[model samples]
Target: MYVFGDSLVDNGNNNFLRSIAKSNYYPYGIDSNRGTATGKFSNGDTFVDYLGAWLGLPAPPPFADPTTTGPRILGGVNYASAAAGILDETGQHYGERYSLSQQVINFETTLSQLRTMMSGPNLSRYLSKAIAVVVLGSNDYINNYLLPGLYPTSFNYNPTQFANLLLNHYARQLVALYSVGLRKFVLAGLGPLGCIPNQRATGQGPPGRCVDYVNQILGPFNQGLLSLVDALNNGSHPGSIFVYGNSYAAMGDILNNPARYGFRVVDRGCCGFGQQITCLPWMPPCFDRTQYVFWDAFHPTQAVDAVLAHRAYAGPPSDCHPINVQQLALINFL
Candidate 1:
C-alpha cells in the first residue's frame, strides 16, 4: 500500500522540505512507541501507520527521506507531505510544499526507477497489486478556499463552485495514478475539520460547541467526493476498485458518542490546551493520551488513529462505502 496527503498521513516527508509544515520536533510523537518524534503530526502513530500494520506491512518510509533510498522502496514509499492540497498553490502560506500534482509526479518518478530495478513482469505485478491510498481535500478547503484573503479560490467561487473545481482536479489526479498502473484505491474523505481544536478556537463558536459553519462548508465536498468515487469505479479504469472512506462520519461517530468508542474527551485535545496555539515545544501534554480524541489542535491521538484505522479496515457500510480497505485490498481487479 502507498500513502499520500497532508499532515494526517505525512510520516516525515515535510521534514526534508523547506516548508514550515513540519512535525519533526519535540512532543509531536511523544507516544509513538519509541517515544521520539518521527515527523508524525500526532502524539503517536498517524492513521496510515496503524492501517499499514493492520495489513501486515510495516509502515512505508517517506518517499523523500534519506533512509528510504535503495531497495526499501519496494515495500512502498509514502509521498505524503504536510500541508499538501489538491492544487499546487493551495498551501502557499507554508512557503514550500508538495501539491497533489507534485506527489503524483514524484510517484511516477519512483515507478520509473522501480521499472529499472526490477524485471518487467515483477514490476508489473507489483504495480497492479498495490493500493494507492490518498487523503486529500481538507487542506484545499481549509487552507485555500476558506482563507479568503490569502486564496482567491474562495473569493472567486462560492462553496459549491469551489467543491466542483476541487473534484474536477481530483479526478485528474486519480486518473494520473491510474495511468501509472495502480488498480486499487482508497480515497479517504476529510474528517470533521470544524470540530478540531484549531478550527473551533479560530472560529469561536461558544465554549464546548463546534463551529457549525465550518463543518457545514465541508459537506458539499464530502458528498461530491462520494459521487466521484462511484463514477471512477464505473470503469474509469477497466479493473479499478475504488473505496470511499467516510472520514467525516468516522470521526463524527467518535465525537458524537465518545464513550462508545472508548474515548472520554472528544471536544478537547490531550496534548496541551484545546487551542490552536497549544502543543508547542514548551507546552506539556495531558497525563493520559488515550482519553482524548485529539492529540493536539489538528491531529488525532494514537488512540483515536487506531480506532479510525480499525474502522476503515473492517468498518460498517456507513464508514466505508461499497467496501472497506481490507475488502478493497482483497480484490483481484483483473
Candidate 2:
C-alpha cells in the first residue's frame, strides 16, 4: 500500500529528514521490545505497522529512506512526515518541515523511481493491486489554526476556510492518483482533538474535559471528507474508495469507560509528570506505561493503540457507530 499524510502515519520520514518534528532518536522508542527508536512519533509501533502485519505484508518503508534498495514490491511505502498537513503553513511554526504537498511530490518521485526499477507490466500490476492509506489533518488544526501567529500575514486563514481549501486540493490529488491506476484507497478521518492531552490541559471544566468547540469543527470536516469519498467511489474510478471514520464518538467511548477496555487512567498521561500536569521533563516517567491510555500529552500508549486498532478492524457495534483503526482494516476482508 501507499501510505500518505502526517506523523500519525509516518514511520520515519521526519527522522531521515533534517526536520524539527522528528521522533527518530533515543528515549522515544524506549517502550518497544528492542528498546530502540524506529522513527515513529510514539514510543512503539503505529496503526499502519499493525495493519500491514495483519495483511501479511512487511511494514511499508518510509519514502524518505535512501537505503530502500530492494526488489520486492508487494509491500508499499509511507510518505508521511511529522507535522505535515494539507497546507504549507501547517508546520511552518516549527521551521523547515515538509508540508503535505511536498510529501505528495516526494511520493510521486518515489513512484517514478519504483517504475524505473521494475518492468512496465510489473509496475502496472503493482499499482493496480496496491491500496493507498491517507491519515492527516490533525496538525492543520493543532498548529495552523491553533497557532497561527507564527505564520506571515499573507498565509493566514481561519480553521474552517483552511480545512475547505485543503479538502479541495486533496480531492484533486486523489483524482490524479486514480488516473495513475491506484484504485483502492482507505481514507482515515480526523480523530478527536479535544481529548488529546494538550487540548485537555488548556480547556476548562472537570478533569479529562474535552474542548467541545474544537471537536465541533471536526464533524463538518469529516462530513465533507465523506462526501468527497462518496464522489470518488461513485465515479469511474478503477477501484473502491472507502472512508474510515475516526473521531469524537470512538475516542469518547474509550475515555469515558477506560476500565471496560482494560485501561486505568484516561485523563492523566502515562509518562510521569511533576509540577507540570503535562508530560514533559518536569514530570517523571510513569512506572508502567501500559496502564494508562495516553503516553504523552499528544499520543496514546501502545496498549491503548492496540485496542483501538482492534476496534477499528472489528467494525461498529449494534448501534452502527464507527469502530477504531483495527476495525477499519478488517473492512478489506469484508
Candidate 3:
C-alpha cells in the first residue's frame, strides 16, 4: 500500500525537507519510536501506520528515503508530507512541501521502478491489488483558504463554489493516478477543521467551542468526494475499487464520546503552549498522551488516530462508505 497527503500520514517525510512543519523533536513520538520523534504530527504512530499494521503489512517507508530501492519498494512508500495539500498554495507559508501534484509525480517514479523490477503481468497484478490512501484537504481549508491574509482563494469563491473547484481539480489528479494502473483507492474526507486546537486558537468563533462556519464548509466537499467515488465505481473505471473514509464523523465521535473512546481530553492538545500556541521548542508534552485527542494544535494524537484508522479500516457502514477497507482489500478486482 501507498500513503499520500499531509501531516496526518507524514511519518517523518518533512524531516528531510527545509520546512517548519516538522516533528523531529522531543515530546513528539514519545510513545512510539522509543521517545524520539519521527516527523509525524501525532505523538505516536499515524493513520497509515495503524492501517498498515491492520492490513498485515509493515508501515511503508518514506519515499524520500535514499534506500527505497529494490524489494523495499514492494511494500510501497509514504509520500505524505507535513502541511501538504491538494492545492499548491495551501501550505505556502510553510515553505517547501509536496503538493498533491508532486506526490503523484513521485508515485510515477515508483511505478517506473516497479516496471523495471518486474514482469508486465506481475506489475499489473501488483497495481490492481495494492491500496493507495489519500488524506488531504484540511490544510487546504485551515492553512490557506481561511488564513484570511495569506491567500485569496476564499475571497474568489463561496463555500459551494470552492468545494466544486477542489473536487474538479481533485478528480483530475485521481484520474492521473489511475492512469498509472492503481486500482483500489481510499479517499479520506476532511475532519471537523474548526474544532482542532489550532483553529480554536484562531479566535474565529467563541472560545471552547467548535467553529461551525468553518466546519460547515467541509460537508459539501466530502459529499462531492463521495459522489466521485460512486462515479468511479459505477462502471466509469472497470474493476476499480474506491472507498470513502469518513474522517469527519470519526473526529466527531472522538469529540462527542472521548471517555467512551478511552480518551480523557477532547478539546485541547496534549502538548503545552499558550492558549493559542502548541508544541513549541519551549513547550513540553503532557505525560499522558492516551488521554488527549490531539497531540498538537492541528493533529490528532496517535492514540486517537488508532481508533479512527481501525474504524475506517473495518468499522460499520457509517465509518467507511460502500465497504470498509478490509472488505475492499479482500475483493479480487482482476
Candidate 4:
C-alpha cells in the first residue's frame, strides 16, 4: 500500500525536510517497537502502521528517506508529511511538505523506478494489486482555512465553498492517481478536529466542551468526500475501486464513549502543556499512555490508532463505505 496525507499518517517524511512539524525525538515513540522516535506523531505507531501490519506488510519506509530504494520499494512507500494538505499552499508556513499532489508526483517517480525492474505488463499487474490510502484535508483546515491571519482561504471562501474547492482539487488529484495505475483506494475522511486538544485550547465554549464551530464546518467536506467516493467507484475508471473510510464516525464512537474504548483522558493530550498542543522535544509523556485518547495536541495515541485501524479494516459500511480494507484487499482483477 502507498500512504499519503499529513501528520495523522506521517511516519517520518518530515524528518528529511526543514519543517517544524517534526517528531524525531524522545517521548514521540515511547511505545513503539523500536522505543525510539521515528517521526511518527504519536506515542507509537499511527493507524497506518496498524493497517500495514494487518495487511501483512512491514511499515513502509518514508518516501523521502534516502535508504528507501530498491527492494524496499516493493513493500510500498509512505509519502505522508507533517502539516501537509490538499492544496499546494496549505502548509507553506511549515517550511516543507508533500501535499497530496506532490505525493502523487512522488508516486509517479516510484513507478518510474519500478519500470526498470520489471516488464510493462508485470509492472501494471503489480500496481493493480496495490492500495493507495489517502488521509488528507485536516491540515487544510487546521493550517490553512482556520489560520486567517496567515492564509486568505477563510476570507475568500465560506465553509461550503471551501469544501467544494477542496473536493474539486481532490477529485483531480485522485484521477491523476488512477491514470498512474493504482486500482484500489482508501480515502479516509476528516475526523472531528473540533475535539482535538488544539481546538479545545481555544476555549470556544464551556469547559471541557469541543469547539462545535470547527466540527460544523468539516461536515460538508466529509459528505462531499463520500459523494466523491461514490462517483469514483461508478465513474469511467474501469477496475478502479474507491472506498471512503468514515474516520468521523469511527473517531466519534471513541470520543462519545471513551470508557468503552478503555480511555480515560478524552479531552487533553498525554504530552504537552495546556494550550501548547504539540509536544516540546524531549518532554516527558504520560505514564499510562494506553488510557489516553490523544498522544499530542493534534494526533491520537497508538491505542486510538488501533481502534481506528480495526474499524477501517473490517468494520461495517458505516465505517468504510462499500467495503472495508480487508474486503477491498480480496477484490481480484482479471
Query: What are the per-residue Cα lDDT tens digits for candidate 4 across 39-66?
Result: 9998899999999889988999999999
How would you encode candidate 1's per-residue C-alpha lDDT over 1-334 as one tens digit per residue? 7888988899999989998888777788888788888888888898989998888888999988877766888889899988889988988898788889999998987888798898987777778789888988888977887788888886788888888888899899899898878888899998988898888887558778888888887888889999998898787578788889999998998899999878898777776677674477746788888889988888888888898899999998798988998887787744
Say which candidate scores most in TM-score. 4
CA lDDT, every prediction?
0.85, 0.67, 0.86, 0.92
Evaluated against the true structure, the overall lDDT of model 3 is: 0.86
User: How many steric overlaps does candidate 3 have?
Assistant: 0
Name model 1 segments beyond 4 Å from true: none
lDDT of 2 by residue, 43-116 (tens): 67776776666666677888777875455434677888887887777777565666767766776777777877
Please give the RMSD of candidate 4 to the true structure.
Answer: 0.8
lDDT of 2: 0.67
User: Model 2: number of clashes?
Assistant: 15
Of 1 and 2, the candidate ahead on TM-score is: 1
What's the lDDT for residue 77 in model 1? 89
Runs off by more than 4 Å, candidate 2:
72-74, 151-159, 204-207, 272-284, 317-334
Worst 10 residues of 1 by lDDT: 270-279
For every model shown, what is its TM-score relative to the native structure? 0.96, 0.86, 0.97, 0.99
